[model samples]
Target: MNAAVHIPEYFEDCDLVEGEDLVREPAFWLAHVLLTMGDPGEVERYGVDASAYEAMVDRLADPGQPWPVLRVCFTGGHTAYVVYANFEDENNVDFFVRHPAWGRLGHLGQCGADEAGPGLSWAELISLAASAQDGEEGLSDPSQRLLLLLPMLGDADMPGGARDTVARALAGCGIRPDAAGELAASLLGEQDSTGGPRWTVTGDSPIAVCSSPYSPRRVPLGLGISPEQAQALANALHGSVPPTASGGFTG
Candidate 1:
């Protein structure tokens, strides 16, 4: 009946178990966190939009692939994660901030309160964030630092600026309006042994990097192609990488 009565507590310091089961079903995760953690309104958009994201894996996930697992912990602690999402371009790189259990820090709560918040109050989080700038770590540790985002306007309870921050963070993990853009951007194409396509598209983040920023980065656009396919894609893209780019990256 009522969801609040059975709220769960935070996970252990480094407990990484069947988090996949929890993330696979977003509604349960949201309710569990909201009830157990209380709706701090830091990570989520509050209703449908937030629900759409949290439940996305369960709603439309590839069962063939292993469910993306996550871990949770208190301030300055570490959890486990299944993916290290990121995206690289010519110069920069961006990552998805997964707390092993905290899910996406951007989606958990306001900075520092949720996974990235280190369980601190808003005031503490702000101060921590301010302090990070003076040190070697600039918001690298979620416990010690926090993302200062507050909902400022519109249907989105999250501020436009804050929303952008979350948006970029989500992008770091390949969560965006165009989920397939990664495959659509390349002028070249090939397929993996499992018939997976080897193409290129501008992704928000590269695979297997879970940090933050969620900005656009140089995505490693490499594909393994047979001689025939290589020639074709190369021709399409105005020739291969001049032998060096044309060489086999792995073997």
Candidate 2:
């Protein structure tokens, strides 16, 4: 089947169901995002070797204590993620505390990357994956502003395949394959194209436009965790946050 057929038209405008408080304990919360939204290439780019990460799937399944849940809040300028767990050290803090979603809460102090550059939310990430634009950078302009990426890479079961599926969908929309890196760029504001952006990843007047340099490195997720498990984690985190004073956000 043509995977492009499933791609959404307005990648940035795609609907996202806001989750309640999934993040309570920052460490555990960070782990959850690392499990789900972390960018492996970013990790590698920062000199963090993938080989050094100890696969935590086994720990997540410990029955005695399942992995902590994380819920991230979304906004036009930033994202906020809450975690529920007993955090211990810098490793946990480094992974989640520095995450883009949680960083919106001033959790990272001046260490936040999005403060100086374009960052993305999971919703935006998914939207880019399903759009006709380049998923990563390097296809055309490396400094394009249409795209934003979060540093967290993979936690979902089908990492590489999943990335490919989204890429194919975007390509179906007419985006070039070389622009794959754009998929990780930040999605900010709605674009009112005069005649709809060209699906072509290259050349001016293309269907989609990427705003930054997208790294080509495809990161890895831990083994054994299923998409269902990830969804469950998202749901659990939702139940933890309290509602707003206006009677909204029934976590």
Candidate 3:
């Protein structure tokens, strides 16, 4: 179940960015895809060889390419896969999620347009994946679910205005507003070992948000969740407010 084996050879040398927090901004996901599409300034900043980078982009953009252009690996051999053959020519992309234990592949959703019209953007698809995986174990604790949802705030003022937002959201789940506010502030302000906001839910082998090896972006990864729960949570969080467009990617 070594998920790394699933990574295509073309991306072998490319850096893998991981994290636990759900990144909710379309711009954040779009920026990464756009970077791979060719950002001369970003290439120069990263000191990547111009010609070599262009060659990788060419291979990724090949119309006949069959593998995913990007793979977001989660804990326990779960992965969220993305395919976009030519970002320059089309804004569309397809998304899939795989669970090794279940031996099942789930079509989460798609980004961009088709005969069915516009689809979810990359940000939306990622958010859906995160939410689905976060609730996979079926942790019913209001506080735990709050932790799972907090990262979706994405750089918002936590324990300040955002505390009220979390409290309000939790109130609907039966938590008192005042206690919910306190819990939200406590969790949002705490940092993980990497100095990023914490996202560890409480339970045996509890799910924790972890930082990416090569980038600042964080995503939640864990085990024991059913695909049905993943889909249900994804559908619920899909309507939540989108993240504000302020963060920037460094890798």
All models: lDDT?
Answer: 0.25, 0.26, 0.37
Q: In candidate 3, what are the lDDT values of residues 39-89, reduced to their tens digit?
A: 334333333345655665554445454433344443344555555534435
Q: Pick the TM-score winner.
A: 3
Question: What residue pairs clash in candidate 3, if any at all?
Answer: 18-212, 19-218, 19-219, 20-218, 20-219, 20-220, 136-225
lDDT for each residue of candidate 2 in 1-251, tens digit (9 for 90 to 100)? 11111112112322222112221222222233244334434433322333433334234323344223222322221222222222232112122211222212222111122222122322334432223222221111111111112333221222223344333333333334554335422211122344312222233221122232331111111112344433332332223333234322211
Q: What local lDDT score does residue 94 receive in model 2, on the 0 to 100 scale?
A: 20
- lDDT leader: 3
Output the better candidate (1/2) by lDDT: 2
**lDDT score, candidate 2, position 139:** 15
Give the residue spans of candidate 3 off by over 4 A.
1-42, 73-77, 86-91, 100-251
Error of 2 at 148 (Å): 2.8
What ranges in model 1 sit over 4 Å off? 1-69, 72-160, 177-251
Per-residue alpha-carbon lDDT of model 1 for 1-251, expressed as tens digits? 11111112222322212333333333433333233223424334322256464555232233333222333222323221222111121111011222233332322222111233112212222222232222221223331122111110011111123323323322332333242233111201221224321223334322211122221212221222233433332232221222122111111
By TM-score, the candidates rank as: 3, 1, 2
User: Deviation in angstroms for 68 in model 2?
Assistant: 32
C-alpha lDDT of candidate 1 relative to the true structure: 0.25
